[model samples]
Target: METDSKISKKTSQTILKLQQNEITEHAIYMNLAKRVKKQGDREILQRIGREEGMHSKLWSKYTKRELKPQKLKVTIYSLLSIILGYTFVIKLMEKGEVVSQNSYALLTKEVPEAHKIYLDEQKHEEALINMLDEDRLQYVGSMVLGLNDALVELTGTLAGLSFALQNNKLVALSGLITGISATLSMASSEYLSARSEGNADAKKSALYTGVMYIVAVILLVLPYLIFPNSKYIHALVTMLIIVVLIILSFTYYISVAKDLPFKKRFLEMATISLSVAGLSFIVGILVKKFLGIDI
Candidate 1:
């Protein structure tokens, strides 16, 4: 009977975990549904929420205990849904369900209801895919173009200027001037390209591209500006770090929301940006040596 007691204790612990997860997910879905404006999307979220609550109840029956939803988890996911869009938060949560599938499989050996809950979890993925129809997803390409160009071009330009000028203040001034001019030029080019392609929202597409580009420029150039009249090498290192962080963050966001491969995309982008910067740095050194010009 001692062996039987240990097995029972382990099973009870597993049931409690499932119970917590189900209740937490139910609150997250319901909170997301409340934020959604579309009736169809809201209804779908509500239906999923109801099903999660039922799953919690099923687990409760075996444990013979009540479990409260994880309030902090629900709050965090709800805030993420508000800021990152419902689709992204839902997809992120669904990724967690993949891990829970193993737990459910273990439970199925003793509890028949666990199998039914596992099947319902599979159905939720399909429903989530169909329900996600956010507008920002459509403009992702334009944003990518803006962000990538700013990172590659500005990083190269700043690296070149840093060596050529050998002064942080001069480098910062030159970078700001070049970045601002490029922002306007890129916006205009995007507008023309969109119009030529017969896109109905040409102006909006251009706006999104331009805004993203400017944001990247500001972030990338901030180090130089802050460290002006001081350590130029330190500023340059900081800027490179910022570029990597930007690439990492944007790649992760795209990978999660669009179901793209993150590692390959991130490595490709980082390699290209750093390669250009390295080439530009070498070119800057050669030009300064050959021309005998110092600013």
Candidate 2:
């Protein structure tokens, strides 16, 4: 009787495995439906896919089926592994809810079934979010570097140029124009580079970088508009602005990431800003000598 019972349990476990595989496979197909633009069609398909797996698990659990000792351990381990792996990936996917919501905006484009799956996943994501602490540095690092880098580089570049060009209105105008164009170009280049690394939101980092650059340029160059007669004066005022920008950067880092030492942070920013300025000064001297212009 015990042998017969064991045989029955093994048969039930085999059936559960088959059912779980079928459901998981179907779920993959339903997910792929998005690539083919079958959003609504994929919704029902997705639910069906999930139901299949649930049904299999429910059956095995309810039946007290004794799967082979090794196989049962492996199955338990695999499930645990999946849950752990998806915790991080699912949060990332959740962060892109804005993108997914847009994907479902149009009625014609809406895959009702896919939409359902999305909604379900959204809830799942929310639950996961509640379980996980919110300190993951998803967009913050990119944004911080974008803003800080632009402020340092562009401010130093313009100040160095103002020193070299010294009070020529035309030279100042030319510098401003060049800086604006360069900022935009750099931003676009960064965005494309990030996009190649993967994900649409990744491109936003470049935009933020470019925007920060424009702010840096404006902060430095705005003083020149009023003091066009004395490039030296403009350069002096811009230096004051640079100091303010540096302090602000340090303050921001302190506020957001309190672990960094103030002196270390200040030195890092100063090193980069001064290094760029030095390089720009050299470039300006070479251009002035080669072109035979007094700029």
Candidate 3:
């Protein structure tokens, strides 16, 4: 490794930033490790944390100045780990690690050690990241089932009801009744399905599914409650917008946490949902025209 004096000013600055990042991640992982109850998880986190510290120390020889962990970053990750779980927080940090890997590539000419660090981070940390297991992630399949079904079913149902009923309160009431009934049905079905599969967490899986389904229901129906009877169209537009936003949000989360492709998943899910709603809206218009229904 070259001396700090020989390294360019720009290179030194980048090294300092990378060093701070490594120390911050070290703090976060160690903090989580201490807080974690599982022995296996604690060991993994501790090992990762120590490795980050080692990276930080290696970079320090170039910067030639001690850098403290960024307190704000550490605090934020700690809080998020508490609220969102360690799995989610660490997965989120993996994005930063990727950027660091890129930066390390750029530094290979000035610092040959950067290449080694990059490879270790890319390979070893990746394996460790995948090794991490959490209880919430265990029921992700159930949550996905709940969210996907609710979005596709309720969005279509609301679009049709908005046109057929032509009254905001009426649409909202119908949506709520339908949503609640479906929630119960979906939950029971999940329970039975999981039990049949011989899964031990069948009850918990059902709870996660029902809870995710109803939450989507509440958000979808909220627009109808807010708009007046005269503005059912506005309510319908808002509900559709909410559906897209929900898809985007959930898709982004899953992509980050599970390392899935975001654009394809988001586009596929959104297309299915909006297409169903569009078909349902046309059916509503046809049904009303043929039956001569009046509000």
Residue 276 lDDT in candidate 2: 69
TM-score: which candidate is best? 3
In candidate 3, stretches whose alpha carbon ends up further than 4 angstroms from where it belongs are: 1-3, 98-102
- Residue-level lDDT of model 1, residues 72-151, one tens digit each, is 99999988888778888878887776336777777777766678767867886576666667777888998999999999
Candidate with maximal lDDT:
3
Consecutive 10-residue window with the lowest summed lDDT within model 2: 84-93
* Tens digits of per-residue lDDT for model 2, 67-186: 322344334433532432222332333343332364434311322343554465567635433443322234455555655666566655665566567774654586588778878777
TM-score of each: 0.91, 0.45, 0.93
**How high a TM-score does candidate 3 get?**
0.93
Per-residue error at 59 for model 1, in Å? 1.5
- Residue pairs in clash, model 1: none
lDDT score for candidate 1 against the true structure:
0.85
- Angstrom error at residue 15, model 1: 1.9
- Higher-scoring candidate on lDDT, 2 or 3: 3
